[model samples]
Target: MGELIAVYLTVHTPRYCTYETAFAGKLAHPDFRAVRDGLVEQGRQLAGVQPDAIVINSCHLVATFPTVVDGTPRHRGILTAQEAPELIHGVEYDFPGDYELASAIIDRGRAAGHVCTLAADVHYPLDYGTVMPLVCYLDRTQRIPVVPVSVTLANDLEECFTWGQYVVRAVRERRRRAAFVASGSVSHKLVRGPERWPSPEDQELDHRFARMLADGEYEKLWAWLPEYAETVEAEMGGRHLAMMLGAILESGRRFAAALHAYGPSSGSGNYVISLS
Candidate 1:
């Protein structure tokens, strides 16, 4: 059986690509640069694992009815983010897709009584939440193939977690070494200004959540998720984290969790963490 080699939680801000210097300048205050650098280091570690494919759960691609997997054999597009064109305009990307593994995930999810489908649209462009980390962490040549999974907003936390369990089973049944990435921020309560930070209460919540993750307290995290998501205004309704937790739990293995870095961006708490 194939094993999950590593799991990562990473931030997906265009600022990492568009405003590196400005982001780094605030290192003394919030250490944004350190977080970015730490993610790069984590990426390097992932590369060393030599995974055949990386299954990514992206918060940006929210599906309504069934969970969607990007199964295109090849992906190439120019991304101009609708949410923030100024930050991520005309960004071109080309990456190989893992059709075989993606198809297996869809079948496995359906067998498990979850709504899942494969997306083979050649014109489909990836959102920044999926692209930014790929750009920063993976090699430019894109040696490893990717299986991009979408988050379902209509699915509650439990459903999302069940979908993740299906993903884990699919990867293992295929007998392929894989790495899983959860790309999103936490405590996302947008305010008027881009430079503003989250409230002190939100910051504390972020820290506690991070601590729970580091301590491998999945039960506690799940128990507190409903209230915590509402209180902190979690990004993507906390589906990304829910999916990651599900995958970790389904693996039936204990991981040494590490909090690589954490910082704030536009009132959101961005964190870089690794589980291995």
Candidate 2:
């Protein structure tokens, strides 16, 4: 059967799509440089796995009511991020979609009584949350098949975790080597400055939170999630993190690969973390 190769947690801020285009070359921070270095390192680690396919759950790909899994045979889109069109515009992307894997995930989830659906619509658009990770992680010379997962508003944290359990079953049934990525931030209280970091309180808490995950302190992480999400204003209600945690839980709570980087992007806490 298929085996999960790795789990990655990273940020996909639009401004990082390009080197000089962001902030009109004005915004700069030591954290910015640190994160850039971290991404390069993260990319190197991902490349080593040679994953047959990638399953990504992006915070931006919010589903209507059911969990959405892309089943299209081909994925091609131009993304001009709605949040910041000027800085992240006209970015073209083309990648193959894993119809089989997507189907298996849906079937397994449906059988388990979860609201999971396939998104096979032609040319389904992908948000920056998904694309930016590809840009940062995937090597374009060889276009690996992508199975994009969505965080649905309908499911609470527990349901999302169950959905992830089904995802693991589906991946194993499909018999393909895969990678799962959680693409979003921790402390996401957006303010006016791109280079600005979150408050000292948020910064301290975000570090602790990420450390909890890396340390495989699931009990403590869960215990602190609600307050932490509210206090730091986690992106998308921390659904991406919940799903990632679920996926990891299904993977037997394996130690996090290594948390190599943590930084701030427009007041949000981002990290380049690996868990396998």
Candidate 3:
């Protein structure tokens, strides 16, 4: 069977901490509720498909190295509950060809000055962005293997895309049944600083991107640049989208929908998206 992959859904905020007063307070600025609801629905759908594994490409988990995808060590049990104490949790899941792909991507990115690594340990918490959507899609009863693909944001688009293509090639070669989820948002315009806020023009720009993603129009996706920068303010997240897109499309699968699209009109512009 081919690799089963799902891209990351943007849960930019700490919604998992149901009782975090600080997190709850900021929820109004960027509708954490919207992101949470969308994530829950996505989780339900993923459980229904029951793929061999899931691939979550997220920047939150990006580190200096490649991780084994799951946060568990080989022989420990990693707990997901918020109250669960951190410990030497067992390696919960492992994806086929993930290590190969991560290693190659890291090497390529490093050559281009983008430092990255692969994690096989079960100690660190698989950051929330990776876990939240996971909670939404995966069945509690069935703990499938997970492959986490992360990238450092310290490089140019060409560099990131080069590394991302390597990631896609490795996953496609592994031939596991998987779905790729590219988890991120368009702009971080929501912060209180001078960052540009989302104007009606920005909304127009997001709509155009949503349309491109829906159509699987790679030519248009690749051509996005001067135009995108004009609307997107900063281009940090677009690379994440492009790299994840490359990985998913490389699997020879066609995307059916932009799935869910909602950016918190706040400057943060965090949005959630799912592709099938």
Could you report the Cα RMSD, in angstroms, for every candidate shown? Answer: 2.4, 2.4, 6.1
Superior by lDDT: candidate 1 or candidate 3 = 1
lDDT of each: 0.79, 0.79, 0.53
Q: Candidate 1, which ten residues in sequence have the lowest lDDT sum?
A: 19-28
- Choose the strongest candidate by TM-score: 2
Q: Give the TM-score of candidate 2.
A: 0.92
For residue 213, model 2's alpha carbon misses the true position, in angstroms, by 1.7
Error of 1 at 40 (Å): 2.0
Per-residue alpha-carbon lDDT of model 3 for 79-155, expressed as tens digits?
Answer: 34442323112325322334544454455545655545556564545654555445333434436655666655555
lDDT of 2 at 74: 82
Clashing pairs in 1: none
Model 1 agreement with the true structure over 164-220: per-residue lDDT tens digits: 777788889888788889998889997665456788989899989989888888878
Model 2 lDDT per residue over 97-179, tens place: 89999999999888878877899987688888888768644544338888999989988877877777777777888998888
Scored against the true structure, residue 29 in model 1 reaches a CA lDDT of: 38
Candidate 1 wrong stretches, greater than 4 Å: 19-31
TM-score of each: 0.91, 0.92, 0.70
